[model samples]
Target chain A: MEQSGDRVTLGLDEVFAIAKSVLVAAGLPERQAEPVARVITEGQRDECHSHGLFRLPGCVQTINHPRFNRAAVPVVENTTPAVTKVDAGFGYSLPALEAAMPLFVEKARTVGISVLAINNCFHFSALWPEIEMLTAKGLVAIAMTPSHSWVAPAGGSRGALGTNPIAFGWPRAGQDPYVFDFATSAIARGDISLHKMAGKPLQPGWAIDADGNPTTDAAAALDGAMLTFGGHKGSALSTMIELLAGPLIADMTSLESMDFDDGVKAAPAHGEILIAFDPAILGGGVRDNQASSERLFSAIVDQGARLPSVRRYEARARSLAHGVQIPRHLYDQVMSLPRAG
Target chain B: MEQSGDRVTLGLDEVFAIAKSVLVAAGLPERQAEPVARVITEGQRDECHSHGLFRLPGCVQTINHPRFNRAAVPVVENTTPAVTKVDAGFGYSLPALEAAMPLFVEKARTVGISVLAINNCFHFSALWPEIEMLTAKGLVAIAMTPSHSWVAPAGGSRGALGTNPIAFGWPRAGQDPYVFDFATSAIARGDISLHKMAGKPLQPGWAIDADGNPTTDAAAALDGAMLTFGGHKGSALSTMIELLAGPLIADMTSLESMDFDDGVKAAPAHGEILIAFDPAILGGGVRDNQASSERLFSAIVDQGARLPSVRRYEARARSLAHGVQIPRHLYDQVMSLPRAG
Candidate 1:
């Protein structure tokens, strides 16, 4: 690792090692700690700073919570021909999703489409990693999860919705997968926190004060409610996520998840819903479908429109070539975690 | 029927009859005309004017197209355990979806989730009707379709995407189903046309002129490109629809669909993809999930936020109590069509 004026640069190996050590030291068993560490490292490698080392303190806080299970073993259930359910036993969502991925891929190929439901887990990472995993296996993937209640419905005055995110991935032949993961909320909570840290106000329309009036103050918006991305359309998507990833899977809603925090607000414990589709089984040759998509991609590029993951991929190339750079303060905070026995 | 001022009020039966007569008169067979008419009537009954009687002229135009098959028969194929494909034989999508409905419900109930693909069909109505059909059968439904390439992708300067719409439905016991169908574009094409017809300008963010600059003139936007609803997020969704409903089903993307039009620009001929989910098979009782969703509905309502379908339901109740009202010009247009022998 090398330290500069205000940032530290570390090789990918050192990044993963430090994350894993911190997780393990905080009492997460190896099975659960590894996937979480890998996901965080990938975020850093891709320069998605919000989901990178900045998330370390929250992961440690959640791991140290009384309700968290240190040695959780995710149990997978084959509930139906097209559904695979994983009960994470109150552990991290990453390991549970990792445990059920093979089943997801198998069922998708056999049934043409399948659902993988993960319940009773704490989620604090971006969904692109999991989406890319399925795309890597030559399948299309979609994933969604509800977080703590911090956003308001489109026309609502108070916080009653999570900053729910939806992610999608499509396989590309000999190229990076077409992937996008986004919060239905107008702004991600991490960005808000970053703004608050920098003493900056938010852009207009991003949020409302506690009284439901529009406000640009980051602190006020955090204490109040964040708006959805596309007004009612985004709200509808968020509500759908709450229903599909929540009640349909027999798990906690955002409100219920928030209540479970009992004010501590450690990473929200909830559920996730992931779906996989095998292009070949849908009557199209997988390679042909990929080829067809290339045309659409070309059209977008020809018009000077960049794909959603383009920047991330560019950052990934840089990180692979010259390691990752992180703010010094964030590195110090992560390094402050106490070591385990 | 009763006439007052510039409007005419007709019972639901009359509404269906008029729509069916016009379709049949334009050469659609009874089997195809029935479902199409039913969907249009439902749109009127629910006061979704864009998809109601306003769509009749376009439907007739498409039905009379040279490529349309007047005696088309939809064929359903059980492609996979959880995937059902219906080839509409270049007919209307309604009948194709109708032919596959039973299989969709059965497979979803058995497999916990399923996909229904309708290909080689012309789609010209709202997807809410189909979503509501699945919701009525106690299933959660999501549907999407690509249209003519009249919208541009985010950061793109030309027309490369469709006003792709996505719809979702969730069942609610003894009440109207929770449903929403929205175009990924900033505005629906029909609405833009309506604005043009009314000699009104569009909202600032709704579209761009031919030169790739934002414009409020409805005519310029119609001749140029429409913007997506939520900028990049909505653009991603529109692209997803293009792939999922298009190449994934061996059907046409929006641009290809437009090419097939050859400048005539009739209703889009493409494919639709619908996915169904059964809560009971996913370890939650059907009623339990419905009851759980009720709380979310209540939360939104308690805070002055209205559910997406509330206004439609209200209009439906009023229409049922006192027949639908239509503008005189629209009624005259329908009345002018020649009757089939």
Candidate 2:
């Protein structure tokens, strides 16, 4: 972070330690607290501001809730040769997804592909970390998670889908995997909130106003529904994700999950889908798979393009040297939080 | 059939017969000719004019090539409990995909999910028909295929990605499945061609001209590369597709496939990825899956929006009665072709 004015940078270790302390104080298990911290750490490390330290309070809101089932542990509800369904037991997605990844990787290596469906978790972090974890192990991974409704279907007036993020990762030879994660919306709600704070005008088609008219006023658009990217095509992909991560996993849609939330400021029960394929087995073998990926990426990169993981990796390296900058006000809030005994 | 000004209407059967005759006269086998005919018939029936008779000539250009393997059959190279790879033997994708769908559906039912990688074929049909077959059988499907390079990456000057269409299907009990298919580019090339033909100005950011500057002039944009919808996010999705449908199946990317085409007006050996998930098992069962889907559709439809397949089904009903209307010159061309034995 450039240290000109209100910015204060802290070492990643300091940030992770503080986040872990906050999670424990919020009544999460020590084992569970660590992954959440890493999510926040990597978010800050990789410049994912909306998901990092700034969002800790929201995470705490759910973890500190009396009915949040803090002691629940995820379990594999069913298993096939290549598919597994995990009941998140109304916990957090990170621990559940983390536990499921190894199982998925093992199964994928055996059968060439594997799928893990995790339901009942409140996922509050960036998804690239999860997909990247698998891709780093030389596998191709696709993961999707649903959220409470925030986006309207194309040509529809109501907010009927989540910001519904989907991520994909491909393994590259001796280099970082090509990983990209994005919500299927024209813009994320957080970005809209920032624009509203800055009193900035929004772009056309990014959102619609109260009467369902397209608007460039950030505040009005925020009051309404976010639009899907690519018009009908993005809406179609989002709906597919709505089913795949929700009912297909015996969980619920964003609307259903919201109903179960009962208006509480807490984590709502939700669902996620993770599919991993061992490219070595799915393609020829390790060498052959690597060549195909490297061939594609080298061509793209030569033309001065940046794949998803590449940019994140660059930010990651920068932060490794300069540390993460937390806003002074947010840092004060972290300092004020009760520490774990 | 109704005779209207500037149009010639024929029964659906008549349209299919003509398409089949044309393909067979180009020396395609009867079995192979039938699927291509049905594709054109459905295109006309559903008013998908671009993919209908307008595309038939392109299909014929490939089919009539001296080196085209019209008699080749699709062969499954390997089958795991949940995955299968089919080599199309340098033939057409319609028959190869047709031959593999049963295997995929059966495997998905057994293991809850299955994937069929169909490669070495030239796929030229709209994807819905294939996914519709699965949804008709109560399966949810996702299929993606790569094409000749036509889309440029975000912030890049040259076209390095295909229009790369993807399709998704969800089963709806007692109704046509919810299916939608779309290309990842900001606009399809055919639409660009139409714009160029009509001398229309395009909406800004639809494409970029030489030197990578954004352009709205339809003719110049047609001479340039189409942009990915919503910028980098869509570009990422398109790139993910390029690898999955291209290199993963031991097939070539758009550029590679073009190189092997050797300037012939023939179909390139392309690849596709097809995944089938039996929601009946993936969900609680068929009823539970139906309830969730119906819940989603009901809410969206009440808002006066129709999912993709519903409109197609309506057109299908109309065409069944009114027949498909073939344009005058196109009908004349079809009439001029020699009839098959």
Candidate 3:
């Protein structure tokens, strides 16, 4: 393999190959490794850098831990026509989530809406991929996950909540579907790490130090707490996620569990909720729904309207057409990883 | 009526009476007056000043217009085992929303999840009252509405989208539960009005001028555009609401050719969607679901957790116990309205 400094720039195929090899070398079955690798690399290819190749090293490190059940498959704990709960059996979260997607889509199609809750699953990759997958099938979806404690309750001093994130997807007529995925926290944990590495101060109102005072210092903020997005409003939503994903799923929450370390493995536990509806069920079915939506959408545009995701969609289209440019630094970081089989 | 100097501190009962009288004098039926008065007054009693008694005069003014169908009741357009759509028939929104609540609750209890879509309604009062009612029944609820265009699309210089508020309620065990309601706009439209009334400049990033230039002057901001919460993310969510509420229910959108000044005369336009889910469906059964939610809620608290909405709940509790304290200036504004009934 050719290397640029300590990093390497590889095409999508090459990146997937590298990721698959690393996961297999870390004891994931060869068959399982490829799919997981594909998911991560696709995230990078889509320009979601925080969740893509940047996370490989950490994930590899996680897989090497004795607690990870490389061979385990999730088991269905309970399911109804409208809802399903899965026990991930302490295995990787991506495969489990992938496995649940069809079941969720199918159920929603049959009944207009469906929800899937997974417990005891390890880190799932970027939420947008799953939401995109669902929306492509002409359905609306919402997904949420709770992480280890990183955020504080509104107006409080210490960390008591996760940087919980929620993602939503909607299908529009005659345009790329609108996809929105965001963390409830003012800033993502990955951004904090980036700030730390660059020795940069965070923006005001982004975080609080250990004593609960708001701080711009990256290190102090990391030692302290992340603030919720939109103040108390965001905090309330984050807490709701905890209820849905934590106790609701029979999993340990950020507050109830120890830090996410090898020896202190909490239930590969997180929660995700999805809602999907068939527009066809409404008035004249999907076609009428589409026409009405288009009319309203076009009217808004006519009235100086701008649709959400229009910019990102345009950027993505341009990147796809002209080719994405990977920074030399990020390219090098990928090459530094130990070679797989 | 007794007035104190330039202000008045009417008791909650008196405030409700004044509101009811205004609606009645404006030609609303006496029977319909109580619900309208109750919704508006509850806002003040619950500390939501923006949507409380302050809106009474405007609502009364709207009611007096020949376009408002005061005698009309919301008609059920369609109903399924798990879904229903109501045509508000250009009636006052408060009565239409109130008429649909029990139906939504009944269906939710039967099917574990139910969706109710309301169309052709004017702006309803504060969403919290509807959601609070649902939570009190041990059901999770989400309510969203699309309004007149005021917010600009992300990266755009002009107004194109409505503030488009989304509200959620989660029923918890042994707690007041959590209620979250917020406009997608970075600052509410009322805030803009309040700033103009005070002759003060708005903060940067809060709004754009008529020409789409970011401005701090309240008047310019009002003439221009409002910003969305959380930048692109909030903008995306607002767009989704438009899709869900505007077109999804066969309602005429703000984007339609109808004049907003005569919105009350428009064919039952503008849509609202409400979703209710019984937690039991996910937790195996009703008891398990309730127990699980309660357990999760308590465990998080036990582990250095702070509940969301506790502050507001506390404020409300104190207000109820000791009575709400309205500022002298605000009290004066309410007393200035012409006497009715």
Candidate 4:
């Protein structure tokens, strides 16, 4: 890593090494640490700083916590013809997903559609990585997970929902998969924290004050509740995630996850739901559907509209050749994380 | 029916009878008219006037169109273990949905999840009735369909997408199923028409002018493009629907559906995708998830946030007892429609 001014540039290999080392030193076994590190590295490569090495300290803290099982082994079960369940054993979600994904893909191909339920996992990453995995295998994928309760339901005052995210991925014939992952919250909780740290005001509809009044004060909004995007529509999607990824998987809801935090405030421990569809079976053939899908894409871009993830793919290309730049302070923090043994 | 001032009130029975009579008179066979009439009656019962008897004339027009096949019979095929395919044979979507739903539900129970694809259909009504059907069968349901291209992608100028409604339904224990059906567009096209008719200016974010500039003029927005709800997130969802329900099912995209209209402006001819999940299989038992789900509901309601579809359910109860009221002019329009021999 080369430090210049307040930033450092590191090659992708270095990023992976640093992430894996930090996770291993923190307490996660090599088996569980590898996939998590790869996901982190990919985040940096794609310029998603929020989920990159910046999150290593938080991951370490969660791993070192008493409730988190750093050495946990995920068990995958074929519960039904169209359902695959993974008991994550209180471990990080990435490794559990890695464990189940192969079988999940098989089931989807066998049945035309399938659901993957990952229970009792601590999740602190973007859902796009998981979605991309399925798309890479020529499948259509939708994934969602609930976070801690920090968002308010539309028309409600207090926080009762998470910044639940929904991600989708569609495979292309010979290009990067079409993908999008977004929080149901008006804005990410981390963005609000950044605004608070910078002493900046938030947008009007982004949040409400403690007493349920709309507020632009970042600190007040953080202390109060964030609003869902598009009002009730976003709220409904968030609630759906809470139900499908939560109790539908026999895991915790956002409220239950918050209660489980008990002031420790580690990454939210819950479950995730993902569905994959085999295009060959559902759409008859991916090659045939490709033409129709491309038309839609051209229609969007021809009118100067950008498809989602174009920026990420562009960054990925640049990073593959020239590495990624990270803030010096964030790099220093990752290096200074306390080792367990 | 009793006319009071400009409005007329009719019992639910009368609503169904009128709907069925209008369809049969327009040359739709009795078997096809029955399910379509029941759906229209339900729409009026729930006070969704846009899809109620007001739509009867559109159905008649579509049925009478040279391209439409009023007597087309839907054929259901169990394409895969997890997919049920229905060829609507250029007929209305409701009958195709009705024909396939039983097999779809059985597949969901036999496996854990199932997808129903209804193709080559003219879809004009709201999707809630179909979602409610699966919910009534004790399955969690999601349905989506592309309509006429009238909405624009988030950053684009011209119309490249449809209102593209998505609906979700979750079965509850002994209560009405939790259901929500909403268009991905900022507002429904019919609402814009209503606003234009009433000489009311639209809300700012609802639409853009023909030149792609933001506009509050209802007529200009209608001639131009409507915006998606929540900006890019909704746009992504709308795009997903286009891919899933359109090409994925070997049916028409919104633009193609509009092209088939060729300025005739009948209801969009497209395909629909519906997925059903058996809670008993996926979540172990719906009874267990019911408790967790109830708590989430309580949290939302306890915080003064209204649950989605509460108003619809309330109206449904009232309509069951006292029936529904319609504008007298609309009633007369339906009654005086030109009928075939």
| Cα TM-score per model | 0.98, 0.95, 0.86, 0.98
User: What is residue A210's positional error in candidate 2, in angstroms?
Assistant: 2.0
- Tens digits of per-residue lDDT for model 1 on B278-337? 988774532366666788889889999999988999999999999999999988887887
The residue-level lDDT of candidate 1 at A170 comes to: 89
Query: Which runs in model 2 stand beyond 4 Å of their true positions?
Result: A1-5, A285-289, B1-4, B285-287
When candidate 1 is compared with the true two-chain complex, its DockQ is 0.62
Q: Deviation in angstroms for A38 in model 4?
A: 0.5
Mind giving the per-residue lDDT tens digits that candidate 4 earns over A91-194?
A: 99889999999899999998889999988898998999899999999999999998888999999999999999999999999999999999999999999999
- Evaluate all candidate structures by whole-model CA lDDT and list the values in order: 0.89, 0.80, 0.71, 0.89
lDDT, candidate 4, at A180: 96
Give model 4 RMSD, 1 decimal: 1.6
- Decoy 2 TM-score against native: 0.95
Of all native A–B interface contacts, model 3 reproduces a fraction of 0.23
Q: Per-residue CA lDDT of candidate 1, range A241-304, in tens? A: 9988888888888888998988887999988999999988885532366666788899998999
Please write out the lDDT profile of model 2 over residues A1-341, one tens digit for every residue: 23446777888998899889999998899878888899999998988888788878888898866556688787865577878877767778888877776777888888777788887787787888888888788788899977877788889887888888999988777777788899999988888988999999888889988788898898898778889887887888889898998888777787777677787846556888888876655565222545655766766777787777676788889999889887888888877888786
The list of candidate 1 runs beyond 4 A from truth reads A285-287, B283-287
Deviation in Å, model 4, residue A126 alpha carbon: 0.8
Lowest lDDT block of 10, candidate 2 chain B:
B280-289
